[model samples]
Target: MGEDRREDMLDALHRLAEELGETPTTTEMNDRGEYWASQYQNEFGGWNEALREAGFEPNQVWKVPTDDLLNEIRQLARELNQTPTKEQMDDRGEYYGRSYLKRFGSWNEAVRQAGLEPNQRISQSAFREPPDACRLCGDAPDAGLDFHHWRYGENKAGCYLCRTCHDDVHAGGMRPDNDPGWLMGAVENLIRCHAKYSEETSVPAITSRYNIPSEGLVASAMSNVEM
Candidate 1:
């Protein structure tokens, strides 16, 4: 009777594996059967052990059907076929484009509606003047101004900084040993100083004299000093 029961249980396990589209190894089959027996010990106490005692190697007792495995492979292939490719992501303007949309959703929609080039970055020259000094090192240049966000996010009102200063800020300041906040604070103070000077001198002269970036000075003057 015990031998008959063991054969029945092994057959059931093999059928179940076939239905699940998974091929269980001998060790996995044994482990899973034992685990199931252990879980229902109160109702089917020692049944797993009984099967083992009946000369059945639990590991070699079950197998998934080939048809079920093939079905699973087909399903996976279908999923892969439906998934987006890298080219599709680029066409949809993901990543940086997504980030931009998150900040200025309206602008993104407008650009799309107008059929404008998605790859074209905003020209700093479009703005009448620089918003403030370079948020980084406080240097000014003839062109190539970009707004830099202290914290990354959309609609965060980034401060305009020179590329050099911007790189420094991104690098978390020159002092690797010091806290990052120290560099941020230093950059903020420099912006504040530039703002104060912008009030008295020509924007260009103030930038040239102090060797501050035009964007930083402008941004400092316009932005809330408390931040």
Candidate 2:
């Protein structure tokens, strides 16, 4: 029975992917699918896993540059005069708040990093700086480690992951934001400056000198830098 359900879900996902011309998000699948999104989540341990089994790349947040993400969040907050919620982001942001939550560990943390006052649902949690090796496998590869939100959807820090571990967690998924339109010229300048400053300057100093938004942005820029 379980195997039957899995095959059915995979078939459904394949059909949806074909119709959409891309991998459908859980929300997208729920809105237009025969099966509930949670059903897939439950059966496959995660929506991404289901997508993996179905031969589609799951949604990947890391591909989107953090600076681009923060700018949008800050812009939306300024427009709304308050920190935007996930629902609000859905209505207005170019990227989903789910992506922000996955990347930053929580919506509130992403909001705080946007230089906006979060609603304070939880007290501040310190962010774990990117580590040299994959926290799970402890494999230090030549490629810089990727940050993984171990405590996703919460006010807590996450850990580092190498590409292999990152791919496993993401179910070997492709990033959703493949369009190059979001990479504005200013972003290039910000990353270049951040990469140069990251070598010797502290995050605060880099932010002050470049007028960058927050330490989180600096951290993000540094993380993307080639180690």
Candidate 3:
């Protein structure tokens, strides 16, 4: 039954991608698909992986510069008017908390590096506390709650969540590598830059700038500009 369901899902995903003429967003999948997007996320590691299985282009987050990430952290700290807390980051940060930890050893270390006091420290018990209330869904003490990793792997951050929300979070997966919004923004900027550059110059100039010999390669690059 699991194998059959997987096949059905792949077929449905390809059909949707074909209908849309581009990869279907998870929101579109949930709204228009026969299967819930969560199911695909559960079966596959992420929605992008599902799209790959369906022979569609995966929604890959492009490579981001480390300086850009650090700058973003500093900007967030400035906007908050205080050192940003891990929980607050869960709400507002552009990048995952683990990215900071991986870059700076710990959240406090990251904050200190950003020239902010680590006064608003994150505690493990905030993840363990009460063991009754769900942080993600705000369930009452009577409702069951579980500890969930906001980021995976060793020494990662976590939070409390109701059972349903916990399952959803796991099934929904995470972009551990890059921020989805930031990646999309980067893609848009690249497209805009490419379009403007092409509009301002001749194709021969573009080919010369990139040192390409064949017009065929230039055509290929133009065709894949959206990607």
Candidate 4:
């Protein structure tokens, strides 16, 4: 009885292959074949094993284009409005998660190739999606990205940032070991505001621009950093 069912599965697989003129995936078989891919797994140990038994080769990842896989990620990102997790890709994406791992060597690499950030979070304000947007200003790469060191000595491209953030780092003489070094930039801007507008006007202008909470603290920061 089991042998008869096995023969039937082989025959169904062969028929499907002939109709398609190439080896079909387990999903394809499930869609078009008389039997489900699960039935083949029950009899033949797995989809690829069943294909080998049926004289057809398993599909190769290289046969698919790199852009094809990356485009799928891009499409999913547009839908979710963020870089998707591996399980999210497996469930909602057209291709298997393993396909990305095999093609790109890592899921993060695949995300990066799609021109997005890996392990993405809604960063600094309501900024979301296309991981290349500035973590501070939330500017897209079209506005220009600058290579930023994560720390004073660790010259790693740790974060994606815009030219404005890049200039702020230097202009404020910030050598932060982490984060965008925003505090010093605030101090510098507030001091500049003091030079242009009176202290009364400067407080509101700098606070509005930097999103500083304590308006009085701007005066204190200016006092300490004033040259």
Candidate 5:
């Protein structure tokens, strides 16, 4: 009975894949996989093993559409209102990143290879000149200057934050410490402080909103915040 159900699901998925004119997105596959797994629990043992036998990998295959097949599918998807799944986007991003690495050597190299503009260099002479007050704390003799990411690269065009606010945000907002209530409080405080004290009039209020940080410097920076 379970085997029969599994076969039915596989057939359905195959049909959907055919209809899409491409490999199903990870989400699509996983949804189907889960349904099949539940329906065929006794025969397949579990979703993971069943999927593995069915030529599905939780990671690699799910990460992106199947290579050239993906590009074709993407073209088709674009014509319709349908958007690619998050996993599909991530997979494609990884693919692009890998391609960038191959053309260059690292992420920085990839950025440079793509002819993206480099970050502006701050001179040592500039560091010696101190601002009147802490950008975040509103205190004088600001202990250090740090860079903060305002909008993560994944979600928006990136921006910077000053050291005090940066540290406060990290210590208060990231995972473990990543409780929404706490982050909201912290971000609100940071924003209020920035609004009241920071010399930069253009600084936007820090709202305690939640978002997943990307997997590099942004992640590290947020992680380093001592909660």
Candidate 6:
């Protein structure tokens, strides 16, 4: 009887894969599958393994054009009436932000590729370690400094900043409509902060690790920096 139930579950996965003409997600399996996705989880250890047994590819980014993924982001941005932030994407986005980060190196970059403005968030940034003090102002709170993403949604490309500087950068300096001088000054300051905290890391190391494209004008500009 136990073996029969297991066989039934496998059969269900196969049926669903055939019906969908592609691998079905857990949600779709639950909705239209002959057996519960949970049952497959129990029998096959996990969903992807179950898919493997059923002769389908494991769950992964579809082999569609990158533009298709960017289009999804644009569609979400339109619905939000602005570029969608990571939080907004979490709540309503069809695809996961992690996927976008992997594909585009940063969420803000992804937005730019989609021909949209990067959503700016003040008083917030991503950090690898617990922020003990602001990299900019040296203001150390007991609760610690806020992690500020240098670029929106690029948590890896971030540093700690006090609430004040963080707010200021997002509110004006980061905006494309901001004064060009102010933007340049702000960029310089942030680069200094990053250099101080990065412990002699080189520009090429950073660019290579994050898949940052540094060509033409960008390459020339970076060459002037001390790395």
Best by lDDT: 4
Q: Write the per-residue lDDT of candidate 3 for residues 135-218, one digit (tens) a residue.
A: 333354455566654335676555555676555543423333455443223223323344543453345544433223344545
- TM-score of each model, in listed order: 0.22, 0.30, 0.29, 0.36, 0.25, 0.39
Q: Any idea how many clashes model 2 has?
A: 0
Ordered from best to worst lDDT, the candidate numbers read: 4, 6, 2, 3, 1, 5
> Distance (Å) between predicted and true CA of 82, model 6?
0.7
Off by over 4 Å in 3: 1-63, 120-227
Q: Model 5: which residue pairs collide?
A: none
Runs of candidate 5 with Cα error greater than 4 angstroms are 12-36, 57-227
| Residue-wise C-alpha lDDT for candidate 5, range 1-227, written one tens digit per residue | 66676677667655544433334554555564335435433556764555555565635443333344335334423543233222232254324333322333433333333333112122222223332223355343335444344343544322234565566656645422366455334444444444455344221112221111333422333343332
State the lDDT at 9 in candidate 4.
87
Model 1 C-alpha lDDT per residue in residues 37-88, reported as the tens digit of each score: 4332333355555345444454564333434332333343244332222222
Candidate 4 — which residues are off by over 4 angstroms? 1-49, 52-55, 58-63, 119-227
- Which residues of candidate 2, in runs, are more than 4 Å off? 1-62, 120-227
lDDT of each: 0.41, 0.58, 0.56, 0.62, 0.40, 0.58
> Model 2: what TM-score?
0.30
Superposed by TM-score, candidate 3 places the C-alpha of residue 96 at a distance from the truth, in angstroms, of 3.0
Clashes of each: 21, 0, 0, 1, 0, 2
Q: Please give the lDDT score at residue 87 for candidate 6.
A: 55
**Candidate 2 structure quality by residue, lDDT tens digits, 1-227:** 48887899899987765443356777878887778899988888998888888876666421456787888888887787655666667677777666676678766577768887443221122122333334345456787887644233654333455776556544413222543332222223344533442453555644443333356756665565554
Residue-level lDDT tens digits of model 4 in 79-172: 9887776666767886666667766766767888999865454223222222434545545556567654432353222344577765664464
Question: Higher-TM-score candidate among 4 and 6?
Answer: 6
